[model samples]
Target: MGRGYLTKEMKILVTGGAGFIGSSFVRCFMEKRQNPVVTLDSLTYAGNMANLEAVLGLPRHTFVKGDICDPSAVDFAMKGVGAVVHFAAETHVDRSIDDSGIFLRTNVVGTGVLLDAARRHNVKKFVHVSTDEVYGAVLEGYSTEGGHLHPNSPYSASKAASDLLALSYHATYGLPVVVTRCSNNFGPYQFPEKLIPLFISNALEDKPLPVYGDGLYVRDWIYVDDHSRAVDRVLWDGRAGEVYNIGGTKDKANLEITDFILNKLGKPASLKKHVQDRPGHDRRYAMDSSKIEKELGWRAECNFEEALAQTIEWYRSNQGWWRTIKSGEYRNYYEKFFAGRLAGSSAGSVN
Candidate 1:
């Protein structure tokens, strides 16, 4: 099988390009393909330009600071862009439990705005990057592209709504749109609030590692780079209006993942602390990416253990990067935004 090739003349718009996964997509597209990338990001607390510092100077890349909910912003950004990769959203579940208003507005309404723009502009394709959380907790079998949506959190519900909206546009107006629901992604340049980076940073500083509930929640992990590659493959070769599930096929319980982090950091397991679980926390999430594997021949090539080791090393050497964000300003923001929220509740510590 040969590598899939995209036409070099397409102008691509990548929303949320300053965040973790979005930044990875932008970098990969710019480095591997000969297409112009216009990054549309709102620069929310999670969307940091430092994540894209590596590709900022590239001539083929451009950045626009704007919200996805604004139709004018979407229209302005879509100009001359043949394809749109929608990645902007309020994604943290704990934060969503505090205030679902933002999530609903940004993830749902914002997605509608983009789809409307894509339809009006007749974009060649629109790729929506969604999550496995939309399927909620899956105890037995893996979630395929056609599984029922059972979103548990406000964040997941919002994403599920957006996924339907994206697909509806394809079905109704004949727009060329595809969706990718992927498993938990961890890698370099990820924000510290996410589980993997949070654990890595806290463990390195000897801070108590916070694990929600009993720390038995299971998640399938995929490296951010691999997820980005899957998205690229889907954009080029996928069938319009289809959904593709991308996962590492490596399921690890939260406790086991924490233990792996501790071992990788050469730290003792004493730092583990279990806190009260957030409301409506899903127990397990797994994805069957066989559809993508069979159609596009894309599979996660990186080993989970190796990726975990590399991620820990990244944080170890990049303390200055995360330290700046862990200061009074960030803490004050958390206090103001989510002080009495579900995630802030006091609970028993895990062994």
Candidate 2:
């Protein structure tokens, strides 16, 4: 077995650690290992400091507020780091469609900045966290790591470009970059903008659950913790310059998930409002995870319905956490984006 990098005692950096998935990784790593972790995040609309409340005060955990595109910030956070798990980027497809400049600058340019810093620091490993959306819609079968990338959205396009750039660093400069693209992630502390949490919160409030098009779009759902564990495997034992696909193996349609959330919350089917679909919406996304499972002996452990039930419970118990988010800028975006479609369905705005 090839030990790609990092001893048990070395320090690691987790970019965007204050966000949903990154925070999960930080908490998971801090609890299970002795290594110190340095977190860097700029606290965007989606990035919340409260997400890291579990491990903020831990002795080995350090938080830095900075952007990845800033070379100075990247350098400061790169010091004494043996590995980097980069999760920082603009991830929302709707927002990317609204404007793609930020995605390109942050996802592509920022990744370049981080890769250069890692090379200069001689970091033992660079784990480039990515999404399966880079493969676009897998209309049939599953997309393997070696499959061709056919990104359909501005967000996925930026990620595809960044993935190539990360691999280029490994090929050109021997940066030990290993990219892992995972399916849709859902769990506690996720922003309400995503499908699972969005519908869960909306169901809780009796707000109309906006269903895009026919709501039959399919996506492979992986619990955020499971995805975090896969990244951990890749970070430690994954061979350099390789791409691994992580999937939950639980594929569900949008309306099927909506029905589950409505039933779970005791809400009626009346709240589901069919809305015009967004442009370039992929019909389905599926990925083959045999590489990660066979190579690193890692597979998603959480059952979809069970993990989703737990996720709903988390949102139910933590209303204040999500309320604060929905009451802020997200509310404005929601109203502007969905108000036209969601109007006359009991509420005029998300608030």
Best by TM-score: 2
Specify the highest-lDDT model's number: 2
lDDT by residue (tens digit), candidate 2, 201-240: 9999989999999999999999999999999999889999
Q: Write the per-residue lDDT of candidate 1 for residues 1-351, one digit (tens) a residue.
A: 112224678888899998999999988878898888888887788977678888776778877767888887788788888888889999898899999999999999999999999888778888999999999999998998888999999999999999999999989987888999999999998889999999999998999999999999999999999999999998888788899999999999999999999998889888999998889989999989999999999999999999999999999999877886776254454334333432321211000
In angstroms, the error of model 2 at 210 is 0.4
lDDT of each: 0.86, 0.89
Q: State the number of backbone clashes in model 1.
A: 1
Q: Which residue ranges in model 1 land beyond 4 Å of their true spot?
A: 1-6, 328-351
Question: What TM-score, over all chains together, does every model reach?
Answer: 0.91, 0.93
After aligning candidate 1 to the native by TM-score, how far in Å is the CA of 293 from where it should be?
Answer: 0.1
- Can you give the lDDT of residue 225 in candidate 2? 95
Error of 2 at 232 (Å): 0.4
